[model samples]
Target: MKGLVYKGNNTVKLQEEPMPKVEAPTDAVIRMTKTTICGSDLHIQRGHVPTVPVGRILGHEGVGVIEEVGPSVKSFKKGDKVLITAISSCAACGYCRRGMNSHCHTGGWMLGNTLGGTQAEYVKVAHADSSLYALPAGVDEGALVMLSDIFPTGLECGVICSKVQPGSTVVIVGAGPVGLAALITSQLYSPSQIIVIDMDENRLSVARDLGAHHTINNASGVAEAAAAVLKLTDGIGCDSVIEAVGVPASFELCQKIIAPGGMLANVGVHGASASLHLEDLWHHNIGITMGLVDTVTVPMLLKLVAAKRLDPSKLITHRFKFADMEKAYATFGDAAKHKALKVLIEYD
Candidate 1:
């Protein structure tokens, strides 16, 4: 088997590796069929995620077939097609019971971080029953791959956490994949306005096509962007502000454009500390929420896809064979240059 291995100091290499087997009572070995690179993978490569040691396989989103399942795995068996979740949960842990599977004591984001991931011919999945979803017949595998991470992250962290409601005004800071996911899902609540801000005009254009009522290019700077947002909102600011870019400036922009009593949801995976302007926000009665994706909504999302209410496949902008894993990473890494959103990597 061949897998993409992360080498420290901003490097990754595709190398031949031994096949994975079921190693625990609750484990299952998946023969990957389709997978995609995530922004988090780029973060890991850039040395932002220190816990990810060298030699770790670099992926957490994909669809695969169950090659083998341990004795304790009952919900799935050999030959079942499944969607691999980015976060793993025991479903018996305290955090899991609270629906915070991303913090599950025994399993939370182990794949592509602390454990081998799905960017290979075969990858081991822990807590198999809780971490994998059986694929519905005839669904697009490329779209299912989006379900494994970005879509859920956007729905849970950006839309749900921010409390987007009907007739409310919303602004998403970042037009990246996760931001676009948030843009697409936020419409489910029929927010009166959906404004997306990004430095890239190409991404902003895509946001418009995906239903953003307004788009702003933040290239001029935060003040100008905020002014533009304020103008769009009639100087009232947005009812809900979602920060989807994992950067200090983007987070700051979210703070600047939130309504007095608005909710600010931080969906970005920040690798560095971002300042919270408590002094300025003291009189504003605003709410702030951020956390890793628990993927508790995968089932509901699947239903939406089945019903044709949501089309995640629109996020896919490129595809590559398993052997072209390196090229996939390159394209995804230079996303702006390639106008790429999501790059799907498939196995034979």
Candidate 2:
């Protein structure tokens, strides 16, 4: 079977590899039908994730059909359509019991990180019953694939963690896929103001259409951007500032725009260290929080999608065949030039 594998030295390759089988009593093998690369994949390629070794499969989000199930599996079987989860968890673990599945002792974030991921013809999912979502009849697999990571990440980390309240002002720094995902989900809380900030005018335009009350481009400088944000909020900072871009500048911008007693929720996966201005922030009584998605909201999000309250498919701007995955990577990597949000890789 053909699989996209990380070959180290900031690269990936589509290579022929052996098919995966059940590795444990709790595992299941699924044939991938559709998948997409993530921002995190780019992070891995750029040597951001040191734990990922060479030759590891490069994805964790997708939709697939069960080809086989281990003896212990009961919620799904052969022929079931499933949504692959990026974060794997053993539901019975202590961390999982507390709704912190991202830190599950045996299975947190194994897929596409510490284990072979979904960017291939087949993938063996550990803790299969807990790590996969059963597709409802007539749901679009392409959109469901987005929920496997971006939506949950946005909803759980950005929206909920930041405690976005109705009638409050919120600012999201960065309009990339994850930032847009956070923009989309943040509306659930009915924030009176949603300021979408980025360096890309194209993404800022998309963010405007997606429900941002204001958009700021950092083309000049963060100082100018901060001035613009304060102008919108009547010279006061935002009630909540969500950092969706993991870079030092974006994070620092979040600090600059956040209001006193506000929340700063960071949803980006940082590959480098960022400084915290505690001297400036200490007197403000602000709350700063960061986390990996526990994905406990997947069920509710599924219902929202089924009801047409959410449409993740609108985020898809490109598509490629499984064989064109390397090309897909190139396009996704050059998002600003390609005007890409998410690229779906359709299998033969």
Candidate with top lDDT is: 1
Tell me the tens digit of each residue's lDDT in model 2 across 242-348. 89988888888889888998999999877789999999999999999998989898998899898889999989999999999999999999999999999999997
Model 1 agreement with the true structure over 256-295: per-residue lDDT tens digits: 9999999999999877899999988889999999999999
lDDT of 1 at 274: 90
Q: Cα deviation in Å at residue 235, candidate 1?
A: 0.9
Candidate 1 structure lDDT? 0.94
Show how many residue pairs clash in every candidate, following the order shown.
Answer: 0, 0
Give the least accurate 10-residue stretch of model 1, judged by summed lDDT: 268-277
Worst 10 residues of 2 by lDDT: 132-141
Candidate 2: residue 8 lDDT (0-100): 90
Clashing pairs in 1: none
Q: What TM-score would you give candidate 2 relative to the actual structure?
A: 0.98
